[model samples]
Target: MTTLMTVLGIAVFAVGLLISIAWHELGHLSTAKLFGIRVPQYMVGFGPTVFSRKKGDTEYGVKAIPMGGYIRMIGMFPPGDDGRITARASSPFRSMIEDARSAAFEELQPGDEERLFYTRKPWKRVIVMFAGPFMNLVLAVLLFLGVLMGFGIRAQTTTVGSVSDCVISQSAASAGKTACGKGDPASPAKKAGLRAGDRITGFDGRPVTDWDTLQNDIRRTTGPATITVDRRGGDVTLNADLIRNQVAKSDGHGGYVDGQYVSAGFLGFTPAAGIVKQGFGDSVGQMGSMVHATVGSLVNLPERIPALWRSAFDGAPRQPDSPMGVVGAARVGGEVFSLDIPPEQRIATMLMLVAGFNLSLFLFNMLPLLPLDGGHIAGALWEAVKRNLARVFRRPDPGPFDVAKMMPVAYVVAGIFLSFTVLVLIADVVNPVKIT
Candidate 1:
């Protein structure tokens, strides 16, 4: 039964991935058709074609990349003097001034076939280019809404669950100085001192009603500080020595930075099962905030690098954090699925995750850099401005932008992609986030 469940999970994952890609591409196809742009080819994936069929004016094919797909519109690049498809010299379809006309879906069969992508207006072309990312955003929103409308979401409370003993080293509770003795030995904690079942009242005067709150205070003091625990009768103050231990800094999606660690004062406290649910609106807002915060971190990564680099690689002050790649992401996904919640709640959680992922893809692709929807949008706008100026000066419109010029951006994007691929490979080795 476990093996059967595994196969089913894999199958579902594959199907969902493909469906998302197709939906994204459909946005472009639909917009192109709406504007009378000839879409000669629509494909999903990146490598050799596994399946293909021709219908009406377009040939649809699936590639092996399994990551994403594209809608090929001819005439998207600048017109070259090399003369391929010309301006309606005699025919609108077979113009010689065309060699895959810029922003134009002009790639007809080697024989003589006609589809008109170049004739579309500038605004229309812009819409077509933007549609793919827009679709991804829409898909994410739908998934989020579906999940929330189905199984409800809740905010984690500061409530304690169970107390743990023989604490493992990591985070605050793991420090050598912080790990409490099996029983309350006459050690530093017992001396300075502390006892089991002591409800930590505060740290540095900050009220600590729960373990997490106490942790936050401990992590803030990496060296030494005072901890006040509310005993059965009164508050007992003791000095705590903080220690640093390697802990997984989760990147929302199960990805984490392993070797590096966060430090906190250990209290040998754990929790037992009991949680408080947040309001509906607050729950939704929390999810939104999570997505925004994570994406913001990724976007601001450029500024966070040098310091982070020195810490991780160079023996400089220390490293901030590094990114986890695909492997890390997958491990997180598996872990989330592994949680022993009801099937409906599990499904909702998974869908919520996919929705967040798609949202990131949509926003990231729209970043006006090269090799993205924003780049294409920029190209189209530039061409529009150039054409308008030419007309004002009594010269011919410059037509569409050149794709060759955009190759540099594409190369850079390719390099970025390759770097992430390496990260993914390394992530598998560093700390694979496992389910159960």
Candidate 2:
């Protein structure tokens, strides 16, 4: 039964992945055609085509490998200064440029002379290139909002789940000394007569509704403090002196890190969990935080390669924040389905995973580096800047930016990306990150 569920989860993720790829390519195809650029093919995958059909001027198809997708636009790069696709050259770098230039015009038809992508206005070209990643961002936002506002997310509530018998320092806890020793002091919650099932309504004199704010308030207060709770249809106030003690550090997301310790006022009680639906503002805020975190991850990606190598080849444990590929994500999806949780929660988690992946795709593709969509956008923008500056200086209008010249750099970037992807794949297979 577990195996079947795992297979089902993987199948579901595969479908979602295909949809995301097709959706991303559709953005490029639609925008290119709208801008009068001739797009010859819109493919949802790489390698040999499994199925394809010509529609109007474009051939739409799916390939065997569901890894990535692309749309082939005619004349993506302008011809050389001599007004023709230059012949193959002696140097490998020069050959790369010529090959790219030739491929861009390979589908040149009679009417395509004026319909080339490079012939479009720089702004239009920017839109054509930016559309793909923007679509992913839009999809990610919608998915996240659906899961957050529609399905609701599991959150901590004001109700107490359990009260500690004695206060245990985080250092002691991290050392595996969870049980209270004879010298341990009675916990504030236990001493103040706070019990499980007590729904705390206020801390000090301020009204407490959410666990995050309440936890922060608890950490900030020391000495005598007042806690009001709704106990059996009656409001009860308990008084206790909050003490400074070592505790687990906050993850900044209403959660505590297990092994990381910090000195703060200790609460010695666990908050109960409940499903909470977020409003539009809250949902948007959550997405903003997620985007910020994703950007940080991308910025730190280069530093993670060494860790990935160790995990893949040196038998090192995979770090929780290690880079994950499609394989790792799919494995996580399988585990999500197999977990002993409500069906809705499991589905919500899976959707969140897909949403996060889409978000990552948007940010990754937006990098201003060659071979990625953002590279073309950056090139177009640079061309626009150069032309505007020339106009201001009363200089001759420069021709379209020769993107073909950067083909060598694009190839180098592509090679690096491919190598990193393979390393991530190996790490994912040999030492996968498991959420249990």
Candidate 3:
């Protein structure tokens, strides 16, 4: 049954991935057609076509490889400096440029001269190229908001799960010693008669519905504070003298790690965790936090390659913060499905994973490098700048920037990306990350 669940989860994730790829391509296809640019093919994968249908001027298809997708726009690059598509050259670099230009004009039909992608205004071209990543961004935002506001997130609530016997740091609690040593005083919660199942209503006369807010209120207070709890259908009030104690602080990446201790008012009660629906503002804030973390992870990717190599072949344990490829993510989805939790929780977690994947796609595609949507957008912007400068100086128009000239650079970037992807894939298979 567990194996079946894992397979089902992976299959579901694969479907979502294909849908995301199709959605991404649809953005480009729609925008290109809207601008009268002829898109010959709208493919949802990279390999041989598995299914296809022709409609209007576009051939929509799904390919065998489900990794990525693209829409082939006619005349993606402008003609060469001589105002005509050039033949292959002896120089490898020049041949690369010419080959790209030739492919762009391969499916050129009658009246396609005006329908070429490069013939469109720079702003329109930008929109056409930017639409793909923007679609991903939109999908990510919707999924994130849906999961956060609709399904809610697992978080600590104000209800007390357990009360400590005595005051002790978290580190000490983790060392197999539950009881406080001699000379240690009873915990404030225990001394104040706080017990499990008591739902805290207020701290220091400040009403707090959530554990985080209540925790912050408690941390900031140093003296005696009035604690109101809903106990057995009645409000019970108690006064607890808070003391400055060492406590663990948030490490800011979702999980708490060993870090500098801070002096805060300690309340020695563990809050019960529950699913809590967040407000729109809170959801947006969480999305922003995810975006920040994702960007940081991408920026640190290069620094992690060495660790990935070690884990792939040297039997090193995978770091908790190690980067995950699509395979790792799918495996995680499978694990999530096979967890001993409620079905709703599993669905929510899976949706969150897909949302995070889409967000990563949006961010990754927006990088201003060749073979990416951002690269074409950058080229269009450069062309616009050059033309505007020429107009201001009463000089001859520079025309559209020849993005084909960057074919060599694009090839290099693609090669590096492929190498990194393969490395991550190997690491994922060898030292897969465990949720626990």
**Best candidate (score: lDDT):** 2
lDDT of 3 by residue, 21-139 (tens): 88988899999999999999999988888999999988989999999999999899888988779665899999999999999998788898889998999999999999999999999
lDDT of 2: 0.91
Look at candidate 3 and give me any clashing residue pairs: none
TM-score for each candidate, following the candidate numbering = 0.61, 0.91, 0.95
TM-score, model 1 to reference: 0.61
Q: Point to the candidate with the largest TM-score.
A: 3
Q: State the lDDT of candidate 2 residue by residue for 380-433, as single tens digits.
A: 999999999999999999978898899999999999999999999999999998
**Which residue segments of model 3 deviate by more than 4 Å?**
169-178, 250-257
lDDT of 3: 0.89
Pitting candidate 1 against candidate 3, the one with the higher lDDT is: 3
Clashes of each: 37, 0, 0
lDDT of 2 at 371: 94
* lDDT of model 2 at position 403: 86
Error of 3 at 366 (Å): 0.8
Candidate 3 minimal-lDDT segment of 10 residues: 250-259
For candidate 2, give the lDDT of residue 4: 93
